[model samples]
Target: MTILAELPTPAPTRAAAPVARPSFAARIRRAAPPYLYLAPALVLLVVWTYRPLAQAVRLSFHTWNLLPTSPITEVGLANYERLLSTPDLGASVWRTVLMVLGILPFSLVIPVVVGLVAARVRGRIYQAMIFAPMLVAPVAAAAVWQWLLDPGAGAVNRVLGVRANWLHDTDLALLTIIVVTGWHIVGFAVLVVSAGLSGINPDYADAAAMDGASRGRITRWITLPLLSPTMAFLVLMTVLLSAQWTFPLIDTLTQGGPSDATTNIYYLLWDYGFHSYDAGLGAAAGVIFFVGFGLIAVGVVALSDRVSHHDD
Candidate 1:
């Protein structure tokens, strides 16, 4: 009887209450604040940047004169074909390469040297003097160079005692543009490299000095390696944006003249769309350039990643 009573007297179990899932409205309520915060930026990006990009892509497949009255006629790959067939396009790309190469010494090498020197020099005024060019407006700088580079009666030609048309001559036009662009952009590079130099620990240099390392050796081994990341950034920026940096100078000075000698891909695109009124061709070129540059940028980043040594 005791065993039967004990077996029968098991405590009654209560049924578990089911957990409630959040409703769609509750989920939306929880997410509302972040979305609200992001709304303005998202709207602006969609309206200004993404929308124009999408429109350009769409327009690339169609012929458009950019006139409101003109109907957009779908031409499939014709615009791309035309771009490929253009002789100037190929030449423009090569000139662009040369431009980047020409600018590299000024933008990367010279600035680095100047920055290193500036670091050793104990004056903020010296640093400011180096960076003054960057503060000037591009158009204003171009106008000033326009006067200085004049073939006849210009200061440069007068000083050199040569009546050389610096900007108008075919052989000299592109090179002249490169030099001007470099002058304009070098100051910015100096500022950037100087900032990088400032961040490097003096202890490294001190330690190397104590170890009997020469100043040159210290710079070569310690300073440069630590500054690799900054150098890489400058290199990448110079390569990718060289065309853009030269645009204002090209517009104001050359206008893509002297047999299109100074016309890089950037100018070519602008010439097609604005000057030639071939929006479709310009859009096609834009798409190709965008893709090509994007790939280049990715490759550069990868290479920089492998080469750059983070002090951290």
Candidate 2:
């Protein structure tokens, strides 16, 4: 009886149960909420960003003076060709590079150092003081700086005991613009860096310290590696936005004066569109800039992904 029980035996035949699947309407009901939740943002993006981008792209192929009564003449690649052949384009591009390099120390390097220290400090006053400059409107800041940097009666000249034309001199105008732009945006950069620093896990530094690591070593190996993501972001912002940050200041103060010393690509594009009334040229330039910067942004993001160390 034991041997027979241990052996395989035939069982009664039974039908397999049908697997239950949700109806199409039920599936639609489940998926609708996420798309519904996303709809407003999607609509705004299309209306504001994508629509303008598409219009710019369309306008790039046509020549127009931006007058409502004037007809747009389709010029194919003429606008782009003319823009590229212009000597001013090359000079403006070089100046833009200088701006990016000059702004890096203020926006990326100083902010990282200040933010690291600021993260440990306990005071709203210190934070406010560091971030105060960013709160001032760009136009207001430009006006204030114009007075301070005036060649003859300016406080800066008086303090230095020398009358140097800060805005009128071609050599100094670009540098002055860079400095002013840096001052305006450095506070915002510091705040962003401080926020990033706060998100870092301090246990890594503490553990390194416990292991007989020196302060510098702990910071270099533990803290900095963790802070790489923030630094990369700052670098990206500084590179891409250096011109934009200086635009209002340049527009108000220099007006791209002193032989176009302070003119960058952003200002150049604006000059073409508004000052020269060459809408087609401006549109082409804008499209080129958008494409070029988009590529740079992609590269930066890819590099950051490789270099940045996340806690997770």
Assess each prediction's global lDDT (C-alpha) against the native. 0.89, 0.87
Clashing pairs in 2: none
Q: What TM-score would each prediction reach against the true structure? A: 0.90, 0.85
Please write out the lDDT profile of model 1 over residues 1-312, one tens digit for every residue. 111112456775855633786788986886698789999999999999989888889999999888999899999999999989988779999999999999999999998989888777786887678678887898999989989988886999999999989999999999999999988888789888988888898899999999999999999999999999899989999989999999989999999888898999999988988888889999999989998999998898889889998888
Global CA lDDT computed for model 2: 0.87
- In terms of lDDT, the poorest run of 10 residues in model 2 is 1-10
User: How well does candidate 1 match the true structure in TM-score terms?
Assistant: 0.90
Tell me how far the alpha carbon of residue 248 in candidate 1 is from the true structure, in angstroms, after superposition. Answer: 0.8
Against the true structure, candidate 2 reaches a TM-score of 0.85
